[model samples]
Target: MTDAVLHPDSVRARKADVPVVLGADGAPVDWVKVFLGFGGMVVGQFMAMLDIQIVASSLTQIQSGIGATADEISWVQTIYLLAEVVVMPLTAYLTKMWGTRNFYVVAVIGFIITSVAVGLSSSVAMMIVFRALQGLFAGAMIPPVFATAMTVFPPERRITANVIVGLIVTLSSTIGPTLGGHLTDLLSWRWLFFINIPVGLLVIFLVGRYANFDKGDPSLSKGVDWWGLGLMTAFLLSMQFVLEEGNDEGWFDDGMILWLTVTAVLTGIAFIWRQLVYWQPIVSLAPFRDRNFSLGIVMTFVTGLSLFGGTFLMPIFLGQVRGFSSAEVGNTMLVSGLTMFLSAPIAGRIVRMMDLRISMILGFALAAWAIQLGARVTDEWGFWEFFTLQVARGLGTMVAMIAAQQMSVASLPVTMMKDASGLINLIRNVGGAIGLALLTTILSHQTAVHYMDIATAASTANAASTGLMDGLTQVMGARGAADPEGMAAKAMSAMIRREASVLSFGDAFAALALGCWVAMALAFFTRPVKVDTGRPQGGGH
Candidate 1:
């Protein structure tokens, strides 16, 4: 019942050559309890990651439910992301203060309370407030799982642990919209938040009972860096705001975006300076000193860019260009989710067999190739066309993710695992945010440019244009339209817009492919890390 009984001291070698993990009391601990505790935390993490995209599919329903305007409704997601980014890096500090079990359970409790509040909300303001709280709590649940995967399992079992973690992280995000759509259709948007209740309660029980990997250091509170915390919160929140809203608000042309960009830069610089100079920084920058960790963070960022960017783009294409409903879009996107699930075990095998860098490069190359295939996208493309693309993407994401996850933490001492985990996860989320912003900007600019070029070429002087116009006019006349010629012109203009949109999508896909290729090149720079087969020294409970 005590921490000593739940989480053993560390791994010890026996005369029989079997490695047994000992508890705080130096007694052998049950691996089953450790696995179950870690599993509970993983489930909690899945719930946190799932909320990021679940509401995306049913934003309209939620908007109406909360009586929000279209513009105001977007804040439902934006506020959550902003709050989450602010809290993610600070999780390491909190975990060290409260220990893994207490921090995780408290987070789940906070998440559950806010979920219920969000579901019961009657106004946009109330919903946003609760959503921000939910995100803050949910953010605390993510990093510890990554750290635990590396620390709790020995090197022999690390690959399998990484695979499960990688699969859950990617699969949950990939399937979020699909599940959200079905839930909304079967019930309502409120169910999205309501559904977290039972699952959260279960996580609480499991984690409370079995998560005893570490004990709280109450002494850490004395040196808490309040200044650094303030700087980081301001920096991350401002930066996230700029990334989330810059595209819609016309980037630097908008005053708010411009000011926020400046604020973000200044505070970000200050935060870095404070972290370097301050004795006890809120979030440690020590993880960057590890060559593998630094390189792994970069790869992790690219993985997030491709994963989130691809997820964002496909639904837009399906819904806008293909005229698919939310449920239909979800169904179509399931290809990528299923592929990710299937490829996880294979990814584990590949990571185990091949050099980590080689595995990472292969994954990035496959992702680039898949996105490059999407560059040939046409308005007529459907499920089958995207099916091939999704398969490659799913495989590439899983493999790259497992490699990146391992490389990020493998080189760090156990003492730094929590800090490293927080930083890596934060970078990935930031990468996703930046990717969405860049892709959205590209889609907008290219659409207008392509539309103008196409419109200019489709003039009356062109025989093809004239002939098509005439045919459309005749068809409209036969259909008894009053303004047949004018309607034909309008129809031609709409067609041009649709074509322009498709072309822009191709350009965006090309951009994502370029990102993947760049990441592939960067993978070569990472230093190789030794497989960790024994207990990490000096950091165990």
Candidate 2:
């Protein structure tokens, strides 16, 4: 054959009528199949994220259904998170072994089956088992979607893909409680898992048919790092257990917590060492060599802290302090979800137009300011009072998340995208775990401190305290209560507890605001990436 006939460009030129877009690797890009497959993965991602907090508002119902005590019921959520975290770092290795299409489809099918099993569970043990399996399967769905966004799309279209993924990440988690509350009220808590069936089948169909982004390397499975994988699992499971149960079980004072903490520290160190030295590491550490990736990982960790911390605190405040029902709390929380949805498109534009570091700084600063506003909350603060704060939070989260996601992987080689994506996600989850633990500890300790201070101040010596007690006693006596003074004292104690809880929430908000400020400062250290504004040079199909 002649040189012209043999040339790749000439070969493509001969089929001009068939129009093709070349990816970074010089392969023809099927935009339709990419999007269709990607859309399915995104939906799967949404389902997984949504499941994280979907049971939040309906925990009591689930507990009742399964005959679980309040103490045992929390394991339903905790187990899933623990299992999910353990599987995340291993995603890159698994993806290489099975290919993206096979790995993702198997995960979804497993998730769906476990979902059905979870819904049919009749006891707490059965529920936890199925939930853990469900989480394992669902964990496989997240990191690959992120890796796909970076690898499958060309540079110019990456921001758009990142924006969509960011939206799904934030929006689904934000609205989970609200959606769960409605579903539980209308149908039943069992419907939460059942709802995933139809949607998941659709995902399987789309992904199985169209997700052909990469080929599997069966050779990579030959020299598996069993030691590294074992150490990693032990470390993650122990660490997650320590974080999840530490506060509830009295931190270091509890024997199990103390032992687990030691195990976590020891195993974590060993796991890192194993990964660094192993010939075929289950999880690669090479991605950390990139400065931008390291910095982006830090920013993502803080984002998760703020995202999950804020989500956790608001519902507690609404439920405990304001006495809002699950539905009302969900309704109030919907403000942040709506704001995130509305600001997503705007965030995409800003990410494209602004320098990434500047965009990150702006985003983190806005979130910090908004959270500081929340620090001034009162017992009477409700939906309208939190409106502006939620709006700022929503906007800030979208912008920073998209920028962080881009910065974390954009500079890495295509070969490292999978590892980097998985690492980024893993760090974010660890941040969230740490944030929740710290916030819960602070809330509990601060509440006790505040309660004592307030109680001491409201003594018999204080005229206002005496007058209030007398007034309450007179009102109870007028209502024909036999023990007016005793009832008034109890009422005063309850009031003090309520005030203390509110104050503790404010303290938590301030802590989160401080984290945002720290993240904003760190943004300055990230190097700027050169933007690729040039459109893909190819004929339109």
Candidate 3:
């Protein structure tokens, strides 16, 4: 019944070799230790998720403090994401070599140290360096928590544990912008990093003392695949650089972007080649061969697109068009985050009562509808108008995440659990990066197109344009302006541009809605998981 007997040589199987604190009659340990251990891992996962989005709204303030140019300030996020994606998929191998518990504890401590260092940084360069370091450690900490859900817990509890983990992953990113906005307004941008200290320390203390489920393997230390790692690092670094900077620098036009594109292509091929041939690959690619897992990865990708696309768009819309403050923007999103949290139990119940396929179909339908509704937004709309959209997104997120997660790894062999967790998370992050990039590119292109058309129409002698100009001129004349027509023209142009921006946002939302529909179609490809027998059944090892 133990993992050792089932998998024999799984890294998780090695966990059985560790000395466990026994309970009554040498029975399995109580839930207290499991809860403590799981709780600590969850905190670490929370910090990792929070750190990525925490800077979403605070970039402007941090830029001011560090005297960074706009381009340099954007790298604050790019570097962290780059580091995270680069390190994420390799967690399975690293944890195997270092031992899961030891690697996790060290990553927590390192993440905390880097957080303090980032807060103390005087220049943008220093901050970027420290944040990259923070991301490296944070990325390593995340996958293990999910792997723990599958490998460390008993079968009956795996579903519950996964839901809890899923909620943290979804909610942390959901609340990130809001939390960052408040801390920046109430204190300083540095407080964002400093806030992690106490939480990180607490997680460290608990994990260090109570986590005895996973043990390290010294044997994996031999024959470490440094070449595969080097190829992976190169590929991720180059690919992320291109994705993050391609739009600003002019996609294939910029020499740096062009060269990085070539580099990424080459390294990506090489990494895949290495993984296929290497005896000790840095990241296992075998999991993708499973049809269900492949569908699950695609679903997770769409999940990232929905979650990250919405998260990226709302604040920009509020800040630019409506002139809302960071605090206000965060406050609007806080409701959605709470909705996601409150809806987790309902999602959990759905997973237990309904088939994952049905639950996922319903989730995707709701999410697509929610995003489609945002395409109807107008410049005058406020928080109340966005309420339904937010609530629907929150509920949809909970259902989709819980279902996708359970479906992703439910059928993989126990030995492949670590690989499944790491690769699935890697896909999610990569999907988010791709989604944000795609949405931003669309917004920029659509805004320019809309602005040009609006400006062209206004320059003509159309009745609507002329009437608007005439009204503005009379209003300005009544206000005692000398050049009423000129002032009116300028004001009218501004109005046109603002409307164009709003329309551009609508286009972005529509695109995301289409993405959700695509996810819905993919949900049908997922074979039903029958759970009515009171025991979860997975595919063979």
Highest lDDT among the candidates is held by which one? 1
Residue 35 of candidate 3: its Cα lDDT? 76
Q: Estimate each model's TM-score.
A: 0.94, 0.92, 0.90
Question: How many steric overlaps does candidate 1 have?
Answer: 4
Could you give candidate 3's per-residue lDDT for residues 74-173 as a string of tens digits? 8888888898998899899877777667889999999999999999889999999999999999898899999888876654456788789878877787
Sorted on lDDT, best first, the list reads 1, 2, 3
Off by over 4 Å in 3: 1-27, 174-178, 181-188, 478-483, 531-541
- Per-candidate RMSD, Å: 3.5, 4.8, 4.3
TM-score of 3: 0.90
Instruction: State the lDDT of candidate 2 residue by residue for 1-541, as single tens digits.
Output: 0101011122232153433555435666666887898999999999998998788879999999999999889999999999999999999999988889899999999999999999999999999999999999988899998888877765666788888888888878877877898899999999999999999999999999888777788999898998998999999999999989899899999999999999999999999999888888999999899888998999999999988889889988999899998678878888888888889999988877777788889999999999999889999999999899999998998899888888777568878988998998888899999999999999999999999999989974978999999998998899898999998889889989999999999999999999999999998887777655333222111
Prediction 1 global C-alpha lDDT: 0.88
Order of models, best TM-score first: 1, 2, 3
After TM-score superposition, the amount by which residue 264's alpha carbon in candidate 2 deviates from its true location, in angstroms, is 0.5
**Model 2: how far is 369 from its true place, Å?**
0.1
What TM-score does structure 2 among the candidates reach?
Answer: 0.92
